[model samples]
Target: MKEKFLCWQTSGWGLSLLLVLPIVAIFYTAAGESDEVFSHLMGTVMATYTSNTFWLVVTTLVLALLFGLPAAWVMAMCRLPGEKVLQWALVLPLAMPGYIIGYIYTDWFDYAGPIQIFLRDFFGWHSVHDYWFPDIRSLGGASMVLALVLYPYIYLLARAAFLEQSTSLLQSARLLRCTPWESFRRVSLPLARPSIAVGLSLVAMETLGDFGTVSYFAVNTLTTAVYDTWLGYSNLNAAAKISAIMLVAIFLLISAERFSRRKQKLFQQELAHGDDVRYTLSGARKWLALIWCWGLVACAFLFPLMQLGYYAWHYFAESWTPEFRAYSFNSLQVSLTAAVLAVVLALIVNFYRRLDGRRMTLVPIRISSLGYAVPGTVLAIGVMIPLTQADHLLNDLAKSLELSPPGLVFSGTMVAIIFAFVVRFSAVAIGSIESSLAKVSPSLDMAAKTMGYASTRMLRRVHLPLIRRGCLIAGLLVFIESMKELNAALLLRPFNFETLATYVFNFASDEQLELAALPAILLVLVGLVPLVMVNRSLEKKH
Candidate 1:
């Protein structure tokens, strides 16, 4: 039994180390000679890239807060018709990729698009010199696109924080002659700070890692710099250096968030019926809340989705092709494969933790999940370094053996892409499985063991059945994330291979979002599956 347990622990630690290797490889690769390249970049584009990355993080966080905070409060503390629908509706925008939103808005607001055309005719302005319009292809536009898709992170966290607030304290605030505004400012906001801060960190992590939207807008950030350094300039060491810098930034961002909340602890009771104490708003207040909440939903999810649908409909003939079908199939194949592998890994690590409750057993779980903190572009660079080395090693061995050299079998094939996807998305599966496994009481394990059930038998009869739903959810989440993944796919994909994400990005990059609309809409619809399932599951739990 001890041998079996040791084996399980070894497997967990080994798998976790496998995932961590790529990240370590980034530094190893960056450690190669690159002083000249570094100096060149410092003399040229590095400062601009650093500045854009910094401000993009700040601007996106600010915008997401502006959109998310109000919506979270209204949902948590107000009464309105269709409240349930609106609550979930706010999260629907998460299914829309930032690049898709950037494309849609840019198309509409461009010089030749309908919005500018209408503006030109309405004011009788003939040309660009006659009017001023903010470019949707700028840093500000990329931030807005990112905020629309990402604010839901804040919304979900802030809403949960609000829902769990102490109702008694709120009532006490009311009795102390506090207005609703004052009560919210004094009590709710402070209480929700921890959750909001965590959410904002996630947003910042994503903004820092974002490639498609920022790249599409011609806005250079650390992410784009990594991609361009590798591909455009063909400088792998410089790309690794950039990736190392980004990783440092992400680490600092996370550490700062943790530091901020270290001294703060809340012992408030969870209010199961938090909604019972919700303020009843009627007349103007009700209208204002409704507009504020649903208007965001309209702008974020509905409007962009409708625009996509319209474009998809009109361009169906052009967009829907055998090539499109092939890429869609590629997406499904890769996503399904990656999803299954990620879930298997999640189950392995999570099951080991379940069986061995030692504090050190948590190391694997923590290590396995670290991949999620890495951005896709950086991850791709990290993934490439080792795989490329392995490919070269294989080729050399084959040559020495007088065998046919299979070139780039590991690095320049679907293998590389799938590995990166699994590394990038395994965290989603691990979180879902870990959360689900925690719900199964330890007593059940003891009971099964006493009944003479062996470890495998116990997992089969007791754990697996109970956690099957979580496994499914984890798989679905991984699948949806894999389907939407653009950065790793963009960087790691083979010469002619394309997933739906890469396909849409390629077409959109050519200023032909019209031709990409079908795949873009397909991507959105696929992404909605996990969101809808998650919401339904949360509803059941609530």
Candidate 2:
């Protein structure tokens, strides 16, 4: 038993170390350089990148909350026709890659596209200067595009929080003559704080990590700077320096959020028997609700998909290639592998947390969760710098042993792509697993142990059965997340290796919207299944 305990503890620490080492490697690489890189960055692009990234984060956060929180409230508090379908449909956008959406919107809203063309012809406007239309490739456009795809994270969590509120607290507020709005604001919102934080953190992290959409729009954020420094100028040190700055900003934001939430107590008990208190909408209000739901669906799902499908039909028959098929296969293999690995690791991590009952594991768990906080390019750079060094050492050992050097295992290969995906998407699995594990009782483990069963046997026999549903949900979410991952895959894919995301991103960078359509549509289609499943879980839980 002592031996088993040590093994579990060490395994937990080792995995945690694996998670942090790459990030540490990134910091070390940046810090090892002299003050010259910092001064250069400061003189030219540093301030601009910092301002743009900060504003983008703030704008995306606010917009997502505006769009997401009310939608969550409506879904949780009201009964309407096809409400469940609408709820799920709202989340379907979660699967749409920001790059794809950015591409679709850029075309639709561009001067030559249908919307602007129609307006131009109708109004007799000839030049972009004649109309006061906003550019879809600006920072504002990136924020809106990001929020449209990411609001679902907020919606899902807020809905969960709204549904899980204690009926007694709500009742007490009602007894004190509080309105539903007041009760929600004063009582339920406070209880829902943790879920809200989780949701907002996801949105901000994703915004920071974004590469495709921002790059397409020519937004000069750190993600773009990372690419520019590495690929354009051939300066890995400068790229590493930019990534380090982004990481610092991410750490600061995370710390501030943590400090803000530190004073709030998150514990709350659900009523043993309580159903959602549904409000009936009146005639005009009913139509308003319908319009609002459909409007969000149009912007979030319908417009971009229709645009992509239209282009696909217009171009695919003429331009389909064998390369597309191969890239699709590559995407499937990598995404599915990463998804499975993330879910499995999540299961182990959760189990370890339960077994050890120590606060030490929490540090690594939080660090692992921080992957979602950093940009994909930044994280990819972090992963790449250290992995390359490790790869070199391994190759040296292999040469000494007279074995073949492992040239592509850690860098420029499927393994690295999958590792980055696991780092980026595991947070999704962790959330699902924690929720699933919460439904399981500890008494079963104790009872099994008391019956002379080993701890492993107790876990296998007792905990696994209860947590299976969570695992399924977690795996599905990770699969969906991997399907949509873009920046990490783009930067880290091996030579001659391509994924669907890389295929679309290549064309998007060149402004070849027509060529990018088919793969983007397919990516969105693949993402819909998990999105629907997550929505179903939310509704059923409510």
Off by over 4 Å in 1: 272-275, 447-453
In model 2, the clashing pairs are: 209-375
**Distance (Å) between predicted and true CA of 463, model 2?**
5.8
For each candidate in the order shown, give its overall lDDT on alpha carbons: 0.91, 0.81
Give one digit per residue, the lDDT tens place, for model 2 in 360-405: 7666566666576667798788788877877889899999999998
Residues 178-252 of candidate 1 have per-residue lDDT tens digits of 987998999999999999999999999999999989988889999988988888888888899999999999999
Top candidate when judged by lDDT against the true structure: 1
Taking all chains together, the TM-score of candidate 1 against the true structure is 0.97
- Clash count in backbone of candidate 2: 1
User: Model 1: which ten-residue window has the lowest total lDDT?
Assistant: 269-278
Give the Å shift of residue 48 in candidate 2: 0.5
